[model samples]
Target: MSRVLIIESSARQQDSVSRQLTQRFISQWKAAHPADTITVRDLAVNPVPHLDANLLGGWMKPQEQRNTQELEALARSNQLTDEVLAADVLVLAAPMYNFAIPSTLKAWLDHVLRAGVTFKYTETGPQGLLIGKRAIVLTARGGIYAGSASDHQEPYLRQVMGFIGIHDVTFIHAEGLNMGRDFHDKGLNQAIARLAEVA
Candidate 1:
């Protein structure tokens, strides 16, 4: 059976547009693929630690040379990576914080995008190791940013996902979420419609 890994990064537990979209996507996906296994990792509730010196030491140092703290740090990071490696599909739900993804989501990315594990150095250039996977990103924004230079979320995520060999990526954005009622409703409905078509 196919495995779907969902990473949720919205901080709000209630009335979160990203969360709502994710719930809809999950429901539709389950209806369409009853045999697929879905796993959700809520970064806001149980946030992963940011990349730090201990994680760096854990990655760089040999097992015999690494301290207990470093080994523990590495173990946690490896678990995240292993989950991604086992998944056939990835779903990321992110709400616009500043101009980019949430810090918690970034931390999870740092854990999974490992060298020689998810990617490796090649004779010509760097190469991604993970292949045959697809990603769908559900984003909620306060204002319209899609196709604009100020839209940092989509481009950065595209680059990062591409770096890790996830090229079949689709982004569904619910923009103008904090705008007037008309704009909010329109944006959310449009996003949900698109998600229905895709999922």
Candidate 2:
């Protein structure tokens, strides 16, 4: 059975554009793959704590030599990574906050992007351990940035996902949300129509 994991990081629980688009995409995806199982992790509602010095130090320790604290840290990291590894598809609802992803989402990334787990260092450079997984990122922005030269969100997101071996990544942008009602509606409509082709 195919498993899809959704990571939602919008602070606006029900009213977020990113979240809404993600839901639409998932609905379409489910319609296409009726037997797939979907799992959701809402980061804004249940935020993952930022990694601290203790947690960082704990991560550096060998798993067998870990103390109780280190063990707990390892367990948490393992749980996050395990979820990603087990998923056949990933959907991320990312809203642009200060031209980047929300901190809650970044915290989740910190937990899951563990060395020797999601990726590893080799003589040939760092290699991603996870493979054969596809990702769809639904992003919302205040202003119009679909094809602008200043839009950094899409490229940054692509680079980050690529770094973790998620090369088959697709982006759906709900941009110009804060511009005006007409622009917002236009942009959203375009995105929704495009979803039919991709999802």
Candidate 3:
């Protein structure tokens, strides 16, 4: 059975467009593939620690050399990375926070995107180790910025996912969320419709 790992990064527990989209996607996906296994990791509720000296030491130092604090930090990263490594499908639910992804989400990314684990340097250049994986990103934005330079979410996510060997990616954006009712409804509706099709 296919394993689907969903990373939830929305800060708001209620009335979050990104979370709504993920719920819809989960329902549709489960209905479509009943045997598939789905796992959800909520960053807002249980946030992962950002990259720090302890984590760095944990990664760099050998197991015998790492202290208690360093070992704790390393364990967290290992757990997060292992979850991603086990999943065949990755789903990210992101809500725009000051024109970028939430800090919690960024921290989670820092934990999982490890050198010599997820990616490695080759004779020519860096190469991603994880292969045969696909990703779906559900983004909620305050304004319309799909292909525009102001839209930092999609492009940054694309680059990071590609770096980890997830080339088959699809982005469904719910933009104009803070705009007027017409724009909000339209954007959410369009996104939900697209999610239905994609799932």
Listed per candidate, the RMSD to the true structure in angstroms reads: 0.6, 1.7, 0.6
Candidate 1 clash total?
0
Q: Evaluate residue 53 in candidate 3 and report its C-alpha lDDT on the 0 to 100 scale.
A: 95
**lDDT pick, better of 2 and 3:** 3
Cα lDDT, model 2, residue 77: 76
TM-score for each model: 0.99, 0.92, 0.99
Candidate 2 lDDT tens digits, 38-136: 999999878887987657867886667777877777677778889999998988888989888899998998898878888889998888777788988
Residue 145 of model 2, lDDT score: 71
Task: Assess candidate 2 and give its lDDT.
Answer: 0.84
- Report the poorest 10 consecutive residues by lDDT, candidate 2: 144-153
Q: Report model 3's TM-score to 2 decimal places.
A: 0.99
Cα lDDT for residue 174, candidate 3: 95
Off by over 4 Å in 1: none
